[model samples]
Target: MIRVLVVDDDPLVCAHLEAVFGFADDIEVVGEAYDGAAALESVLRHRPDVVLLDLRMPGIDGLAAIPRIRAVDPPPAIVALTTFDSDHHIVRALHAGASGFLLKTTPPRELIALVRVAADGHTVLSPTVSRRLIETAADRHVTRGETLARLAALTPRETDIVACLGGGMSNARIAARIHLSEGTVKNHISQILAKLHCTNRTQAGLLAQRAGLRPPRPAG
Candidate 1:
């Protein structure tokens, strides 16, 4: 079963998540927290597979708490919960080590699927949010030659994988696009993360974006 911890300041939201995941046979709602402080305590106590995090809260917001949570041994995949998808908070959350982002109004079915995807080391960017991120990235004209130069350390195949990752493709899709086995794609992703010093593919993408690179389009 995929263990999950739900964190949000709203009691109604917490209860809603608990109730939603309660019926999932493959998922277990292990614990709940009202704020960042409570989240830290609940997470250490439960060690869940994934954490549903709210971007804004009373004390420590989600972005600030990300590094702290990552410092925890066996850090869970953090999927941020937010109301607005177009804000800089989404980018900050991803940069801070969040694996995925879901608008508060996302359908429960879609949210559950994304949670599963994140737990499996894959990302599920909301289509609308993703399009916006792409446009936002493309509209910026800042220079990042120095950062892109770091790609020199990667092998040719790994470079391809990184570009695709920045474009937001699943490992399975990348494998298909690159004509390699999914296992091979997974290994390449691991190598890219290590070499890039990124916590996850989402961060790696942001790094590439800041480095002045546009991720390749999703393979047809």
Candidate 2:
């Protein structure tokens, strides 16, 4: 079962998440925390597969707590839950080690699916939030020349995989798009991780975005 810990200052949101996961056969709500301080304690105790974290909360908000949670030995995938898709907060959260970002208005089913996808080592972003991130990244100063220099070690195919990762496609989707078997895709991802020195797929995705590597458009 996929263990999940819900962290939000609002009790109603916590209860709602609990109820939603209670109905899912593959997921179990392991614990709940009212704020970031409580969230740290709960994470230490639960060691859940994923954490649904609220960005704005009373004392030690999600943004401040993310890196600490990630320092835990077996850190769980953290998905930031926010009401707004503010570029500032989104970039901060991702840099602080959040694997996914979702609006609070996301439907329950989609939220569950996102958590699953994140726990499976894929980067998940609400579509609008993703667009904002891309726009924000485009305005940043990560020069293509510098990015290419940093990625000079990658093979051409590995670079292609990185672009797909930047687009937030999962291994199965990348496999289908590149006409490779899923196992081959997984092997390529492993090599990409080593080449980029990224600890996880989320980091690789962020690097690719910062490097301005856009995946090719699908042929109609």
lDDT of 2 by residue, 1-220 (tens): 9999999999999999899888789999999998899999999999999999999998999999998898899889999999998777887888788888898888888888888888897778876575757446432566767767878898888888888988889888888887889899899988988887766677677778778788766656
Can you write out model 1's per-residue Cα lDDT over 1-220, one digit (the tens) per residue? 9999999999899899988887678999999898888888989999999999998998898878887898898889888898888657776787788888888888888777878888898766665575667435422444467667777788888877887777777888888888889989888888998998888888776665565555455458
* TM-score, every prediction: 0.88, 0.85
Query: Scored by Cα lDDT, where does model 1 land?
Result: 0.80
Clashing pairs in 1: none
| Each candidate's clash count | 0, 0
Off-target runs (Cα >4 Å) in candidate 2 are 128-130, 179-184, 194-199, 216-220
Predictions in order: lDDT: 0.80, 0.84
Candidate 1 stretches with Cα past 4 Å from truth are: 134-142, 209-220
